[model samples]
Target: MGRGPETAQLSKYFYEGNDISDLPVNLSVVWNGNFIIDNPQNIQAHLYKCSALRESCGLCLKADPRFECGWCVSEKRCSLRQHCPSHESSWMHTSSGNSRCADPKIIKVG
Candidate 1:
């Protein structure tokens, strides 16, 4: 589906809850595509969630809009630019200033 102006070309296919500070575990589902869940119990569960997807990128947010997409962090700085499917796979890095990411790296477009 085509993304609207309010939304970007990419979309987050997975998520987890921030109610609890811990991660999740014992997840059962297809080992492909991103998965969003809540009330995690451990890191292993998150690892599974990460591994389940073919190209899982972006930061795991606790909410939407304020933390919309995969690049939302409420600290001293924040970036609206969605993270690449793979952290290391990305060549760009968002700096603390504007809402967009800087330092663009050329990737081989398939």
Candidate 2:
């Protein structure tokens, strides 16, 4: 049996042409063309990242937005504002004003 008229376009979206990255990962049944990832945990697990573990100033500053972490330019460490260098000026996140990391290298994208 074929998909009814209501779901035909959605079926075409998945089967005919769809970016694999755009597929819903949380759903147990994800479809893109003939390939499918059921219960996508492997890729989901990769999503969790600790901001403190980021090695470089740029890496820490450019980290995932979900986790709140800042780069201490002087200390050369990545941590939350409370844990960074014990000085508010040294800690630099995207929103911090008067941050020590005013150099051209530490550009924060809007």
What lDDT would each prediction earn against the true structure?
Answer: 0.33, 0.55
lDDT of 2 by residue, 38-110 (tens): 6545544222333434767666777665566678766777777777666566778866664445444645678
Superposing all C-alpha atoms, what RMSD in Å does each candidate have to the true structure? 17.2, 13.5
Quote model 2's TM-score. 0.41
Give the best candidate by lDDT.
2
Model 1 Cα displacement at 66 (Å)? Answer: 10
Q: Which pairs, if any, clash in model 2?
A: none
63: Cα error in model 1, Å: 12
Candidate 2 segments whose C-alpha is farther than 4 A from its true place: 1-53, 98-110
What is the TM-score (0 to 1) of candidate 1? 0.19
- lDDT string for model 1 (8-93, tens) is 24334444642332334454332224445443553334312311221212233322333233332322122234434433333223
What 10-residue stretch in candidate 1 is worst by lDDT? Answer: 47-56
